[model samples]
Target: MTQRLPFLDRLAVPAIAAPMLRVSGIELVSAACRAGVVGAFPTANAESLEAFAGWMARLNDEAAAAREAGTAHAPWCPNLIMRRDPARVRAEVELIVRHRAELVITSVGSPAAVIPALHDGGCLVLADVASVHHAERAIEAGADGLVLLTAGAGGHTGWANPFAFVRAVRAFFDGPLVLAGGLPDGVALRAATVLGCDLGSMGTRFIATEQSLASAPYKKMLAASSLDDVMTTRAFTGLPANFLRPSVVNAGLDPGGTRRDGVGAGGAPALRRRFRGRRDPALGRPVERRALGRRGGRAGHGRAGGARAARGIPRVCIGLGFSLKGASETPDGLRGPRPEARRGVSLAPDFLQ
Candidate 1:
């Protein structure tokens, strides 16, 4: 049987904007909640604990104001990378508990040790899992839900087909299940529900949004990129991750032949420099407008969550090209027409509204 959590039942859109490193922040998270979806950001994204506290305050304040206005805003979630570093994990856990965060997403390690504290504080914990083994372990460790990171998800991802993964997990546990990876539109969101997932989690699609913390060129690059432009490599973080080839090259490394000798030796610094430029801007800024077109959809493009429709589900198009100079394709074997720029398909209006 399917399970329902209080927060999941309150969703206006059965989706959660995945907490992304560097890309997610107050603006993106707040905008998502305002648009009626759960908004989240990683604790690692904060420059320090002080900064994280400030972000938490802002989110709490926004949520209060929304409540006062009688607006149904989805809850704000903060992601904690449960690492072996005991000190770091302890500090982050303390913050989550102190703030009484409603929902939390944990990654990189087990939540077994931390789940009880969070639960006692009325926080729901969702563990990120790439395989069935991890899913079972997470549940055994007391996670309230499971977020299956399937293939094509941005950042560190898994190769499991979402359908098979969800089926396998449901066989054992039926609590709230969230599916992540390549869910760029409402149709994909509907598909997740049909597959028995409580929520569809997405990250890359939001990188193109103006509220994101990514640079202008980075946002443009994501718009111009496709599955072909994505390269899975372990050179950056000692774990497998998907990165845009153009961004790799822009950092002065060979995308085709990049290598790292040790954890702190090579590629890591360059990759960091590429995203976090010499001078980064503050967190608060006005949201910009960027267009993303859907495959086989009409010619109506607007800001994130602002697309229009005629007789069916509104087509929210995100421009699939991000090359500043508009490079048609990458030189690597990964090549294809931009996936987000096509048109002609439609979804039932009922599923969308």
Candidate 2:
């Protein structure tokens, strides 16, 4: 039987660089692809679908050229956050299809709407599901593949054992499975393969690479700390995610304390009631991804959930900002068309490594 996702055979590494907002941009994507792995960026990072179209246009051209020139190349992907918002979600879906994105990583909700669009566009769809039940649902929803997020994963994660997770999913499905969590290096990559995973997912490790959009402090923290220094908090996005010690301290909260001092009185009651309905790990509640580096889920966009430019850390708004000029302010190589200055998000880069 033919597998739904045939792109795996073209990859040089059994790794899919996780789509990190702000951090995983074209520069990092291109770099990872050049390094023989699947590189991805979040569609949410683009200001609009038109911008995403342009971004993908350039990336597709590059990838095509590289392949033509005999350079080892892998497909580039963009993540789409599926939710109740039909308009926004449809726009993103249209962009992915129009751009012919070889892979689409769906997260935060169902893979229902976009899967047909992706299939029509001749693209592979991989849903970011934290549990086996979610994986089954995604598969039933027509996903071509699944990205299994186990415990200790950086973003919204499932608190399941990886071995158990693999076993549970393998029992019913044998399609393309990319295991995500803490696979940081070659050894971890080997282990995942041994566990029957076709591929490994990595996010933290790339946050330290030259191409990453992470600030100096974030990379430093990743290099300085070990797994012991990492902590999970629903405070960041209303979703349980692992974070670094420095970010916790910068947000003015005790890393060990789970209580939030400023939670709203009315909102807390509503949130509690909502959590009651979402007590099951599967179909988890939506975690609000905000910026500004605040602890806990908030709206907008800063450091609350998405990979954001670390506050108290230098912001390299070089390409996306005008009036900024410096070697350190520029992206890794300044190769492609000069991208506008983009905000640098701080992220711990060593969890997988």
Candidate 3:
């Protein structure tokens, strides 16, 4: 049996807006929460601690106002990539505790050291893991939940099949399990629940949403592309992750070629610098420090305009292409009806029957 959190049990939609490094922002998070799903963004999206604090303040204020207005939004989540510089990780953990964010997501490393602090502050921690080994470690580290990032998940995803992954993890731990990868529609979400996952995590689908900070070109590329367009490579981040092949081509790098200087688990340290400091030739400008700190005016790594300009590198890490079909009009060539055709299938416990 799945061990449910009171908060998760109350969600109208058993889904979460997976945190994408360059796509998630306050606008997207707030929108998803308002629409009855858990909305999340990454702490690393902020260029500095001050900016992170400001973004959190804004998010909290907006969420509070929404709740007072009788909106049934789920708690907002901030993903902390645990494998970055130790000092940076500590600082982020401090900020998360200071804000008392109700839900926190940890990825790319063990949560043992950080989980205690979050738990102490009455925050629920969900660790992202690609395999059962990591799943067991996260559970031992006292994470309240696990985000099983199986094959096809965007950004440093695991290679396990969701079926085997969930079943394997369920054998030992039943605590709120979320299945992440290729969850394109209500049917996929429903299937995850039937497979014993507490919620289905969707990233790419949300990228095409109006609220997302993804650039117009990025969104257009997603809509036009298919699974065949997604290539898994460790070149950019030094860890295997899915990226759009076209983005690589646009960046003047061969998607099929090997440029493997950095390759290892937890590529956070090296990738962090590149993601923040490298300007993409495609965006045509350097990242201004002021823009990164701006509160109401696009303040994260993933959003449109300033954010994209700031980290002006070719966009990689777009997740599985299958999920984008619903939001896209372009056919993927190999097809059935687009995901949008199927509707009204609810994963909510009350609506399940």
Candidate 1 ranges beyond 4 A from true positions:
257-353
lDDT of 1 at 8: 64
Q: In model 1, what lDDT does residue 283 have?
A: 18
lDDT score of residue 84 within candidate 3: 58
lDDT of 2 by residue, 55-99 (tens): 888888888898899887888899886643678788888878888
> What lDDT is reached at residue 44 by model 2?
62
Once superposed on the true structure, which residue ranges of model 3 sit more than 4 Å away at CA? 256-280, 283-318, 321-353
Give one digit per residue, the lDDT tens place, for model 1 in 1-353: 67786876557889898987667888999899888899989887777888898888888888889889987888889987765467877788788888879999987678887888899889999999888888888888899999987766676555577889999998889899999876778898899989889999977768767798878877765665544456553333323345666665664434433332111223333333333322212212211111111221221111111122325432332222222111212222012112222231222111101
Output the number of the lDDT-best candidate: 1
- As for lDDT, the candidate ahead, 1 or 3, is 1
Candidate 1 to truth, TM: 0.73
Query: Per-residue CA lDDT of candidate 3, range 200-269, in tens?
Result: 8888777766778778877766666555566554333223445565664564333332322111232322
State the weakest 10-residue window (summed lDDT) of model 2.
318-327
lDDT, each prediction: 0.64, 0.60, 0.63
Supply candidate 2's per-residue lDDT for 180. Answer: 79
